[model samples]
Target: MKFIKTKLLLAIMTSAIISAPFAIADDTSFNSEIKKAIADSKVGISFRARYEGVDEDGINGASDIEATALTIKSRLTLQTGDYKHWSIGLEVDNVTAVIDNYNDLTNSYNGSDSIVIDPEGTDVNQAFLQFNTQKVKLTAGRQRILHNNQRFIGGVDWRQNEQTYDGYRIQYAVNDTVSLDYSFVHNANRIFEENSKKSNNLSGAFHFANAGYKINKAHTLSAFAYVLDFNKAHAMSSNTYGLLYQGNFGAIKVNLSAATQSDAGDNPLSYDASYYNAEIATELGKITLLGGLEVLGSDKGKAAFSTPFATLHKFQGFADKFLGTGSSTGMANGVEDTYITVKTTLNDVKLAATFHDLVSNEGHIDCGTEVDLIAAYSFKKDYDLLIKFASYSANELSNDTHKLWIQVATKF
Candidate 1:
C-alpha cells in the first residue's frame, strides 16, 4: 500500500530528528499558541532556516547534482502604535525539499518514489501591510521587494525559494538623501520554483516604478519604470532607466552603473537592453580586493531581465548562474551572458574567480562558455566552509556542463 505510506513518512521524519534536542522543552505549550495569537493583538513571530546545495553536470537542462533545500520561514507581526501610522505583516513559508531538486537521487528513486512533498507544494511566504508617515511609506499586502542593483526587482536570495509580491508597494523619502520607490506585481508568488517562480495563470500581471537619487558627495541614483502584462499573446513588457555610483578614493572603492531599456509600448519586437556595472574594492592590509562587472543587452527576442523582486546571489554570480530564463533556438530567452569577478579575503581565507561568455544575444550567437571556482573558510565565530566549482560549455546549445557548490551558513 504505497510502500506502507512511504515507510510511515520516513519513520516520522526520522523520529523528528532523534527527538529534537530532548523535545525542546516540550515546545513550551506550542510556544503558548504563538503567545496566545498576540494576546490583545500587537502580534509578532519570527523564524528562519535555510540550506542550499548545488553540484551539477547533466548537460544543461540545469540541475545535475547535489540539490538540497529546506526553507522554513515564519514571520508574523501586527501593530497599531507609534501613533497610528500603522503596521501589519505576515509571512509563512514551509519549503521542505530536504535535498533533491537537483540532488538527482538517481532521478527520483528511479521512479514512483513518493514521500509526497513538492508536487508543487508548500507556500504562503508573506502577506504584507504597512503605512508610515514622515515622508510616506505605504505598502499593501504580499511583499518582499527590492531595487537598486537588484538588476530588476530582487528578493531571490539564491533560492530555497524566494520572490514575493502578490502586489502594491511605495516608499518615498525625498530628503535625508533622496528616495522614491514603488513596486506593483499584482501577482507572483513564484518559486515552486521556476519559470519566473511559475503560476501566472494568465490574465495580466507585473508592474514597477522607482526613482532614487542622492547627489551631493559620491552619488546614488535610481530611476526605473516597468510593466509586464503576460496574458500570453507573445507576452512582453519593458521600461527602464538607471544610474548608480558609489565612491571612495583613499583606499579605493568605486561603483558605477548605467542602464537604458525600452519597449514598454510598441511591440512586434522593438528591442532594448543596455547595462554596465563596475565595482572595485581594495584594502591591501589584510587582503580584501574585489572586482565586478555585470552586463546583459540584446534585443533580438526581448531578453536581458532581472530583479524578480532582488538578491539573485547578490548580483549575478554566486554560482546560482543566470538565475533563470534563456534558451537558444527553441527559445527560453533570459541570460545573454557576460561575466567577470575576482575576489579576495584574508583572515579565514576566501578567494573567488569567475568567467563566462555565452553568446547569442540572438543572431549574436556563440552559444556557451563558463568557468568558476571558489574557496572559503571560517570557523569559530559561528561557522563557514565552502568550495565551489563550475565549467559549462555548449556550442550552439546542448551537451557539456559541470557545476559544484559546497556551502555552510548560519546566524543566530
Candidate 2:
C-alpha cells in the first residue's frame, strides 16, 4: 500500500511537471497571467502566546498533581491569486515552549506532572492547490476542513498544533439555497504534533459527504454521512449518519442535531449507539442566555458513541476529564451533559460563564459538575487578550480539577 501511494504521488507530480511547459509554450498570455497572479498574492502572519496552569486531586492512592506550561505559536501563510481559476496556498506553524513544567504526553514516562498535550515542533500546516468556478470549488493536498459547529469533524484549531487532513475536497453550490460538499481523506495530522510516541496520527480511507438547504431566511437544514476506516486504529473507525437544523427566530435561536453510529473496518468491537443535542439561545437587553442538553448513548455496558475526530475540548468540560468515550476513559456507560451559558459585553470586553451537570447515560451515575469562565478583549482588531478558568467537582467519575489560562494574540 505504501508503495502504491508513493507511486501515485510521483505520477501526479511527474504529470504536472511535464504538462506545465507545453501549456505555457502554447498559450501566448501565460506570462502576463502568471505575473498578475504573483502581483495579487497575499501573505499573512499570526502569533499566540499562552500560559496555562492545572491542578488536580489524585485518584486512588496517587499524589495530587500540578503543572504549568507557557507556549507560543507562530504561523505564516501565503496564498496566490487566481490564475485561470487555479491558485495555491501554503502555511507553516511553529510552537515553542518558554516554560515547560508539564508532561506533554510525548515522552514514555510522565513522572508526577499533570498532562498538558502540547508539544514544541515545526510543521507544514497546509499546502494545497485549488480550482474555483462560478458554482464549484475543489481543493487537494493538506488542508483544513470543518463542518457545521465542528462537533463531529473539525480542525481543532483551539490547540497550538491544529488538526488538518491530507485529502481532496469538492463543493458545489446548486443554487443560492442548496449546496453539497464531499471529501476523501487519507491522513489526519493530529494536535499532538509530529514525531510523538503517542501515535497521535491516523491514516485511512475516510469519506465525508454533506448536503445543505436553506429553507428560508430564518431556517436551514443539513444532512451528512461520515465513513472512517482506520488502518491501525480500528477502534476509532465507524460510520455515522446525522441531521442538523438551525433556526433563527425574531428573538430566539435554536439548534438541533441527531446521529447514529456503528462499528466499521477491522474494528474488534461490535456496537451501535446514538447521539443527540438540542440547544436554544435568546438575548434580553444586554445579556444573552443559552441552554443545551447533549447525550452520547451507550450500547449495554460494552461500548459507547465516540467522536474521535471532533474538537473534544469544546464539548464536555474544559477540565478535560471525559476526553474520550471508550471504556478506557471510564465512559463505557456514555455521558449526558446538561449545560447553560450566560454572556454579556461590558466596556468592550467580552465576558461569558458556563455551568455543566454531567452524568452517565446508561448507569445513571453522577459524573460531575463544572463551572467555566472567560473574559476577552480585542484591541485595534489585531491584538487580543484572554483569560479563562474552569473548575470541576468530581462525583463518581474522575478527580476534582481546576485549570486557568491567560493568552495574548496578534495577527497581521
Candidate 2's TM-score: 0.93
lDDT of each: 0.55, 0.87
Residue 14, candidate 2: alpha-carbon lDDT: 56
Q: Please state the error at residue 185 of candidate 2 in Å.
A: 0.4
Residue 144 in candidate 1, Cα distance off native in Å: 2.7
lDDT of 1 by residue, 1-412 (tens): 0011242345336534533533344457654543443343465554444444444455446544444544444444444233245445554444444454443122224432211122223455555457789999887766677776566677664454456666678888988887888766755554443322234222246677777777756656666776765554233455566767777776888887776765554334565666667778777775656666565555555555433344555544445445553212233344555666667776758887777776544476666777778888878775566777766666776545455555565433
Q: Candidate 2 lDDT, tens digit per residue, 322-391?
A: 8777543458789999999999999999999999999988888999999999999999889999999999
Error of 2 at 239 (Å): 0.8
Model 2 accuracy (lDDT, Cα) = 0.87
As a whole number from 0 to 100, the lDDT of residue 207 in candidate 2 is 96
